[model samples]
Target: MIVITALLIVVVLTLAIYLFYHHQCRLREMAFLMGEAVRNGDFTFRMPRKRMFFGERALLKTLNDMENNIGRLTAQNEVESWEKLTRVLTHEINNATTPILSICQSYLASPSIKSSPYREGIEAIHDTTSSLNIFVDSYRKMTQIQKPDPVELNLLDFVSGVACMYPSVQWHIDISSAQTLFIDTNLLRQAFINIVKNAIEAGARNIGVRWNRQLCISNDGAPIAPENARNIFVPFFTTKSHGSGIGLPLSRQVLMMQGYDLSLAQMPQIGFHVTFIVSSTCGSC
Candidate 1:
């Protein structure tokens, strides 16, 4: 009986030791996966939750949530980075182009040009430079966004006014008079206009808008291709033939300066093909 009791105790200890090592190995593998994913800039992974101990499961959930938030942070950082690059480029272009434009004007005004066969060539240069200036001015809008002047504003009235602008399209507004925001009215209006204009340009004849803390604008126009959605916020990138390519980029810059963000999200609705959500990056509202 004594020998049998010792044998049973030995078996229990061995099993416990083996199970503990297995658990440690499982946790270490999960940690390695998380580290590798973050290092590779891939935040779309979720660690398996099955067979995990209570504390281990909690850790897994937290890591998954952190990955989501990290992805959002990365996106915001990219937006700011592009905005800074655009500002520097636009400033440099303006500095270089202004002097060239002035030189062209001086040449055009000189008396020698009247009889010179080079008059036509000089005029061509003037025309080309003028057009370039105009184009750059439009691109500069992305850089010269105004600082937000927040005010107590009504959402219902504001959206109703915008809906009036597109009298042809049917607008479904789900906002209320009580739903208000402390924001720069004009700046937000400009941003909202660009969003709606893009929907209209996409052939959306019907539009719907709903707001709680964030704004969701949906349209039945063509759905954005999965491959193209990621590049929508990129400056000067557009799929449209006549697109100036600055509308969405400028809207994003305006909202970014105002502590907000615009994203193409897969929102739930049966009829709408695409939804652009305007949310606060600061999590204030």
Candidate 2:
């Protein structure tokens, strides 16, 4: 009887070990598939949950949830990216062509164009078109910027410079400490400009800029609606009719490329807040 009991215990232990190993193998396979899916940008595939194992089923559900979220975000990002490209193309083309067309019309209207003065106007048109082509090409390349050329910057001075561009909006600048930041000056400036423009567009009377551990730009404007808040970072999603919806997304993208984070947060008794997460050590100096 003792030998039989001992044999039964051994069988149970062996079965448990086998089951654990099998479960681990399944997990390993799932992890591999997930990695492949991420690399291939295929988020539609899902692993079947193990009904008998509650823990395994929970993990599968969590993974599936993550997959769905990633898929949705990816789709939105792609749509927004395309829309941003379109807006830039349209704006730049119009900017380049408008002046050229105006010049041509003026030349055509003047009786002097029929004389010996037509060559200069034609030359001007050629130069303008050439510049336009160059700008469009450069703009296209700018969209694919993978990284930023960082330089040390005085935080307050940089923010102040961007704020100076919009004189109509009242600016309140605060610095907890004199912090020098390492960032891409041009890219970060453009990002700041976008944020400030958004504040001005939102009918902000007073815009506040502060730097401590991070940079916080707040405006006393109408708060974003709940639904709009969720998609505020989405590319090409705009509240304004003429809004290309590119400003916030582009700013976010630039910051992200520079290893920074930008977000909209609410402050009690205050208005809309846009925060930029920078280096912590830089905050003290």
In terms of lDDT, the best-performing candidate is 1
Residue pairs in steric clash, candidate 1? none
**What's the TM-score of each model vs. the native?**
0.74, 0.49
Candidate 1 lDDT, 23-100, residue by residue in tens: 889889888987887775555455898998898888888777777677658766776787788788878888888888
Question: How many collisions between residues are there in candidate 2?
Answer: 1
Q: What's the number of clashes in each of the models?
A: 0, 1
Query: How much lDDT does candidate 1 score?
Result: 0.81
RMSD of each: 6.2, 11.5
**Which candidate leads in TM-score?**
1
lDDT for each candidate structure: 0.81, 0.69
Worst 10 residues of 2 by lDDT: 276-285
Q: How close is candidate 2 to the true structure, as a TM-score?
A: 0.49
